[model samples]
Target: MKEDLALMERALTELHPGLYRYNTKEEFARKIADFEAKLNEPLREDRFFLLTAQLLSGIKCGHTYLNPYNQKKEIFERLIGRQTYIPFHFRFIDGFFVITENASEFDLPKGSAITSINGRTVDEIVQGLVSVSTADGDGTTLTRLRSVDLSRENGASYAHFDLYFPIFFPLDRPEFEIEAISYRSKEKVRLKVPAMTKQERTAAMEKKYGKTPGYDEGWSFKFLKDGTGYLKIDNFITWKLSIDYKRFLADSFSRLKEAGATDLIIDIRNSDGGDAGVVTELLRYLHKDPFSCETGIRTFIRTAKADPELLKYASVYDQDLKAALLNGVPKDRYKPAKNGLLEFLNGAVACPETEPYADRFDGDVYLLTGPDNASAAFTLAKRVKEASLATLVGRSTGGNLNGFNGGSYLFFNLPNSGFEFDIPVFAYHPADSSQAKDSGIEPDVNAISTASDAGEAFDRTLDKTLRLIKEKQAR
Candidate 1:
């Protein structure tokens, strides 16, 4: 236990200084001690690792995490079979749990209330879990707490929580009971529903989403006859595909122009973040550039210090040096891009990519965003807003947008039982700062997804965009 704590502390204080800077050493040490004291029992080798996984959840940085080293990969593979995931999508609205989607087996109706999980009230579980959630967005704390891989944090046998609700039983030989309550009447009812295996639920999810054309990976596009394009980008994991992606995007724009397309809808709901290069490449398709947003060197220095490896190279321009430089640089030097992550950097400034998009699409663009819209996606949205090329339509993005660079990890085994920890170093920030860093981009048009709006074949935001496009065409 001491060894594990020591390693964790080292990872925070020495290996990953970013994790330590906000809190004083004595304060952080006390926090660690408090955390250790909270554990009810001594951890087993495997369980220790699971706890470590839970620890990463507390940091709130989207990119930092530890993976299993040693036999953990094999253990993880083996463990995958023993556990099951509760396959349901939910959101928090008005401080109440609302069901957005569920498998037929669960039969939990849309707009149904989720009163409790495993005898614990929804609020209790959320408070316990959200502090460690990587999910970004408004109710993100709650959504992530309930919607994440719970089985990993707790044990596999108990990984699946028993959800109780009032409703008709979806099947016989029930795995769990359903209890429902009327919002107005305040009456409760109960029924038993059979639970679907995690694999079955996963298969259903895949089959359901797999039907969408071009749903393969990374950035995929679909075109509508009315000059509206639906483009879904998965992540910015690599820049090697940027040229190919740009070519395909250019081709799609040519086709849209030929077909008299009037608008573009860029869907960035599920993306967390990736290389800024992807955003830079996408800029090639826009017709105009945006106003400049200066990101001072303080932000850059902190970002550089976040990663020990980055600090190795960036130490020369530490906080003091970077601050001095920012003071000396001309204010007019920086500019915000259509994607802030793609902002151009000068010799001394750390900025988003400044790559120009092909000057092909001059029409209005509609961006479908959500809390899950994060990192690079937020950067892109910021740039688009600045350029006046697109109006964001949807919820505020998950506000944890930090300038991100690729990360590296280290593996360590717990001394007593051989539990392992993974650490990430090397956090980077864009040189420009037109948009707020921690707070995400706010949508120009407030488009929200409601529990009542699910499975309606039409989306309110899509409808709104369609109407706007028609209005523009009429003009």
Candidate 2:
């Protein structure tokens, strides 16, 4: 256990690009010591995993995490495959665990506020979860966004809350003792709900909601009653689907122009980013002038090569890292930077302008953003705000405003525990680094959803944006 912990510490210090970006070396060393002190007694694998997650969360990098998908089958089965999940879907809205969909046999209705779970207050549960939940810098939006299961059909095998809640705060019994305020009656109620496995929860949700659309089918385009063109992009990960995104955007804009639509709303509220190229492609249709996606990209290590000692326990997608001791780093591509870091010469170039499409839409663009707008999606919001290209609506975004660590990663599996965690290698900085390091892109207009909004299936943000457009037209 000690050896594996040492290796983990060494790997982070040597490879993680943003290891010290938000914290000092001494501070990180202290965190490691604190974690080690807890090892005075034996810990179960699940407990150790929780501690490791909390340790990584201190790095403040969104992409850096112990991904459940990458873990071994046995580990996943033992930890998450059990029938330990709460029997409903919910969203944390305005400091309340507002029920969105009830999957259990209970009489609780949508819009009810879950006050407590197994005797733990909602605030206490959230505070404990936030300590372990990973986010970009100090941004709380991503944490709040992830602490829910609003869309079970979005291809995620398990929800964050479902996966971690039971592990963090184990129940004395198999079921959950839940207390909630009734949405319709305005009366406090208590319920004892039986636990469900991941599969069971999916089945219950589908049985109730009739199997809603998945992420692949989530993207859509429609003209509102007021003639505003509404484009809903569920994510930027078009590569996974058969849809030709470039053509899709081109056709959407062409149709809008033909319809003489002077108002367009691009809804990316559910987008947590995917291919950066997709973001750039979308920008071509919206941005009137030439624009670049990033100002610079850098890494801590000069090469993709891994340390010989640690390579055996690490699984890498970067081919250069796979060859480890056999291959050498190409000197021409990487140049030495300050603080013994390596700057990718190819990535350090100034903003390389991309020409706007000839058929770029000239309409007033209203971007509907939310907490899930991180990575490439966050980049889109940042660029649009910088260039005055769109009026952003909804809540603040997820990624850091100054910059974020991504573009590449180093996946490490602790040998003893067989636990896996990833370290983001590249940091992509925006043109403006003057903003707070912990801050996300704030919207031009702030709009939040209420429990009633969820229950009624209403979109407060979109409604507010449409009103603003109508008011502008009135003027």
Candidate 3:
């Protein structure tokens, strides 16, 4: 037990002490002590994992996370060992968990405010979830939930929130009651929903969201009836898929340009972010040279010293990365800012030098953003806003523009529990530090989804974006 904790402490000490990266060494010690005390208790593996994950979530670093694909999958599987999941979809709008769709056969209509599940109020569940949730940059649990837009039908936030929901409200029974008020008629409704088997849940999700997720495609560009081109970028990553993101963007702009489309709409809503390569690639077609994605990166420590085990898995290598490992370990709280390396938390070298596209879209660019526009996507929005390349219209971003912490990550396995958590080696603050810390990139024109808007299945943010796009085109 002592050995396991010693390992944890040694690992915890790697985070930047100056930035209070996750928790101070002292605070981390307290949390470790408290968690250690729970080891003696008759805690289940699932519970222990949850406890540790919640502990790590406190750090609020975007890159540092117990990979949900890895740890979160294990937790969800164990939680549903015997019971099935409450097979339905919900969107948290305004303050209520509204029924957007269902995977199983249920009486709940679209837009019904789900007040409770299994006798627990939505507030109580959400309050508990905040601690377990992964939020970005000084965001509270509520802010995290809202930023993710927990109430969406098929979004990145909903996907993550769905994983923890069953665990947070452990349903031992085969069935549970849901209480909700219909948005259409203002009538209250109650139903006993049966749990869904794994296969059943998959089918339902496939139906609720198309088998090919609406936004799953790399990207798409279609000209609106009004001659404005609408390009929806669901995510930035394309390495896993056959799609080439760089080529996709170049072709997209070429087609739009050939069509002589001037005004454009980019819906980054529901985008949880992917490779920053997508951001840089998109920017290449939009901005000129002599610009950088960020001023510099800050790094107090490096992952190699703390969790060297992760070094073997650091497959995303380049000249910059090899140089760092060869240069010897970072001794102090700061490492020399290396462009194209994962050493600096606030990376000095965010974008690789790219000459502007000989012919790029110079017409008005409308970037639709929200709480879900995060990580690299949020960073892209920051660049666009800083460069004055587009008019941002939507809710504030999920996390801040300048004070981002993403770059590289290493997963640290808890010695005692054997469950794992991730820690970002560096914290990246922006070169332009004027933006208020703890706030996401606020929209130049702020708008949120209204109740009436959802009822008609309308996108108020996109509408506002198009209105501005047309308005500018008129000018």
lDDT to native, each model = 0.51, 0.80, 0.65
lDDT of 3 by residue, 1-475 (tens): 4455556556555443222543555786778788888877677666765676676677676555556554545445665434455666666676677666666576566666778888998778777776776666565333477632343234332355555666676777778798878777788888888876655666766777666353346478788889888888877666565666677777879888899888888888767787877887788788866455455445434343434452443333244543464454565424544432234433333665667886689788889887777788888888899889999998787755446565555455655555556655456655445554667787899887755555567788888887886676678
What 10-residue stretch in candidate 1 is worst by lDDT?
162-171
Q: Residue 360, candidate 1: how far off, in angstroms? A: 2.4
Estimated TM-score for each candidate: 0.69, 0.94, 0.85
Candidate 2 regions exceeding 4 Å error are 139-150, 154-156, 296-305, 321-328, 350-352, 430-437
Which residue runs does candidate 3 get wrong by more than 4 Å?
A: 1-6, 15-19, 72-76, 139-143, 147-158, 207-209, 212-218, 288-290, 302-327, 330-353, 431-436, 473-475
Question: For model 1, what is the alpha-carbon lDDT of residue 377?
Answer: 70
The CA lDDT at 29 in model 3 is 73
Q: What is the RMSD, in Å, between candidate 1 and the native fold over all Cα?
A: 8.8
Give one digit per residue, the lDDT tens place, for model 2 in 77-172: 988778787877788776678887888888888889898999988888887777676678865555445645445643236567876788888877
Worst 10-residue lDDT window, candidate 2: 295-304
Candidate 3 local lDDT, residue 338: 41
Candidate 1: which stretches are off by over 4 Å? Answer: 20-26, 38-41, 44-54, 67-71, 77-80, 87-113, 135-174, 180-189, 194-197, 204-218, 238-244, 287-359, 399-422, 427-437, 455-458, 470-475
Q: Best TM-score goes to which candidate? A: 2
Model 1 lDDT tens row, 147-211? 33222112112231311121111223335454544333445645444455645655665565442
